[model samples]
Target chain A: MQKDFLELIRRASCELPADVIRVIKQGRNAEANGSPSRSALDDVIENCDLASRTSRPICQDTGTNIWYVYHPRSVSQMALTRDILAATRKATRLAYLRPNAVDSITGKNSGDNTGPGAPVIHFHEWSRKSLVADLLLKGGGSENVSAQYSLPNGAIGAGRDLEGIRRCVVDAVFNAQGKGCGPGIIGVGVGGDRATSMIEAKEQLFRLVNDKNPDPVLAKLEKTLHAQCNELGIGPMGFGGLTTVMGVKIGARHRLPASFFVSIAYLCWAARRASVSIVGGVATYSQISQQALKYKLPAVAARKGR
Target chain B: MIRIELPVSEKDVRKLKVGDEISLHGTIVTARDAAHKLMVEEWPKFVEPLLKNGAIYHCGPVMKKTGKSWKAVAAGPTTSIREEPYEAAVMDHYKVRFIIGKGGMGPKTLKACKDVGAVYLHAIGGAAPLLADTVVRTKAVHLLDELGVPEAFWEFEVDGFKGIVTMDSHGKSLHSALLRKSKKKRDAIIGI
Candidate 1:
């Protein structure tokens, strides 16, 4: 199981999901010929190709490992954390991940990629007899651009309704400009406390790029935000062209009466994430994009041996 | 597009203008936040000869050990704005000719570039593997133990590394212009 988990980290780091690749391709096609945006997208596609072929990390900043785990009550959290930490160290040795966990106060790095709160794991217990783990490698550049907005603000004329959310999201994207690596995706959390709102926004990134929102109003807002963000002409790396944003995903949670926070998590085009479910000791890998599974799964053979 | 090789000459760096595409060859050094601070504060005399009139890349590469040697797996540019506080001083002290990074720098760094005959080159931020392919060999490493892998000073012999000149030695900055333009667009979008 540890080896399988290590392989999951390798896959998530080296190969991007199909949905992200699809949207990036669309972004490339949308750009004008001879524009910097087209050239930038070309470089990204080439980088992805090289990373997948060589099984190397897609980006130098392999980023912080954020794991979402769903397991049965039988599985101990301590054991899960231990296995994850071990896998992380192994992954760092393999160069599948960069050592990113740094001590905040001392400004020192934990060279093995494990620190006090590194590889943040969110575990949820389920009734099913299966254990599933999902990993998202959120890079620093995109993470830096993420913003949280308080509603009923006069700036941008934002009010408490959905229109206010739209204004805030757009402003966030605009302010990000090309810094977050545009032709990017936006994950928006409409209602929650400060911490939960940010978490919810980040969670929205786990969804497939083209997946429709379950709620009609949210779906419409997603579509509108997607179009408007692209219209900003921030383009790829802010060189200026069409297709600034590829997708806009929105998720909402009930908020307290006093707080109305809208948090936005800007995800770069890399968007590396992968999942695996172990049911009855049979590990089955689930990709973020269902349409395409082009990369060869090295772990499938390991699972077969089990 | 212009093809420039390192260690870049001051004359060549001055000739570069904003918005010109560039491809670099020869040796360049990688440094980020920690390294920048170290260079500015400690001012390592041992590295001065190697860095003089050379390019400094704002990158924390993914490196793998191959026996005694190291290889770059993914080497991409980091956001340069974070190094704003220390960059001008380091550029002035070291006589660094080229600053290779992504997302651009601020006014102080731009002024230093103009004053010291240096230029800021913008690379594609997430194109790590592609950039790594351009690295021919790892030359040397310094401060690895103290600053960690990403923040360590890694010298590499590169071939045909591509970037756009967003800040020039001639008091021109494409990034600043773009920022102004984008602000106007944003104001119009918000109906301000």
Candidate 2:
């Protein structure tokens, strides 16, 4: 179990999922020829390929370790948590993960990445007699730009409606500029309290880039926001080009009438997350097809000045 | 692309513009949040010799120890804006000619770039392994015991460490200009 979990962590840290690479390539094609944004995207793609090939981390920050595990009722959650923690420690030592957990009050880093709340794990019991694990290595640079807004946000003139949510989303992306590391993917949560809304926003990031939102209203909003964001011209790395956001995902939950909260989770182009399932002692991964992993240089030398 | 050998001068960086692509060869130092704060507070003289007319990378690297020496496995730029508070002071005090980071810095740092005769080089933010491949040698480390691995100052001998000059010595900033244009677009879309 520890070994399997370690591989999961390694994959999450080192590789960009196929869907992410596809959208990034699409963004690259959409940008003007010989633009700096296109060059930046080329460097990004090359970096992902190198990281995946060498089994090295995609980004040095390696981010906060977030795990979502689903298993049968027979399995003990405690034992599962213990194994996950153990795997996290070993991964850090092997340099598959970085020591990122720091003490808030004392300003000390827990060198092995296992302090009080390091490697946050969410456990659930499902009826199926199988186990599934997902890991997200959310880098700190993008995470710092994540925002939460309480509606009737007079500052932005946002009210408690879908329009208000759209306003908040725009404001978030605009504020992020290139800081969130554009071309970014945004996950938005609507209609929940503060905390759960943020969680829902982050959970939306686990969905594939090509997946459509099942909610009709959200689907339309996602489409509009995706287009609206790109029009901002933040481009790749905020160099002011066509593509600022590659994708926008919206998720909503029930909320009280008195409070309406919207949360935006910004993910960089890296978008490092992976999942695996185990049934009958056999494992299957959310695979990255080989063709999607191929690398080529941009038409103009990306490293050369425009 | 412009090739700059280290131990640079104000004149070398002054030639860079907001959109110039450049590469650095020779020794560069890594410092992040804690190290920046410490450097500003203590004004450590030891690192001054290394940083004088040289580059300081805003990076928290992933390193592996091989036998007795260290190897940078994945060293990429962290967000530069986080160090906005101390960056201007660090540059002016240490004579740092290049600030290598991503996401760009704020007004004070931009002013300091002009006043201090420095430039802000925006690295490819998440291109960790490719950037790490440019690190020819991990020369030494400092503050390992106090600041831990990621926050420690790492001295590296590099070849072809590439970036775009987003903020240059002529009082121009690509990031600020982008933000102003982007804000106008956002206002139009949001209608507020």
Give the least accurate 10-residue stretch of model 2 chain A, judged by summed lDDT: A288-297
Please report the TM-score between candidate 2 and the true structure.
Answer: 0.95
- Please report how far candidate 1 places residue B39 from its true position, in Å: 2.1
After TM-score superposition, what is the CA distance of residue B168 in candidate 1 from its true location, in Å? 1.5
* Tens-digit lDDT track of model 2 for A1-306: 888888988999898987788889988888888778989999999999999999999999898787888899999999998999899999999999988999999889999999898888888888998898888878888899999999899988899999999999999999999988878889998878888999888887777666676667888999999999988989999888888988888888899988899999999888888777788777667632111122222222223211
For model 1, how does the per-residue alpha-carbon lDDT over B134-185 read when each residue is reduced to its tens digit?
9999999998999889999999999999999888988888777877877777
Q: Which stretches of candidate 1 lie over 4 Å from their true place?
A: A289-306
Second chain only: TM-score per model?
0.97, 0.99
Q: How does each model score on lDDT?
A: 0.87, 0.88
Top-scoring candidate (DockQ) = 2
Candidate 2 segments whose C-alpha is farther than 4 A from its true place: A287-306
DockQ of each: 0.74, 0.83
Candidate 1 docking quality: incorrect, acceptable, medium or high: medium
Tell me each candidate's i-RMS in Å. Answer: 1.1, 0.7
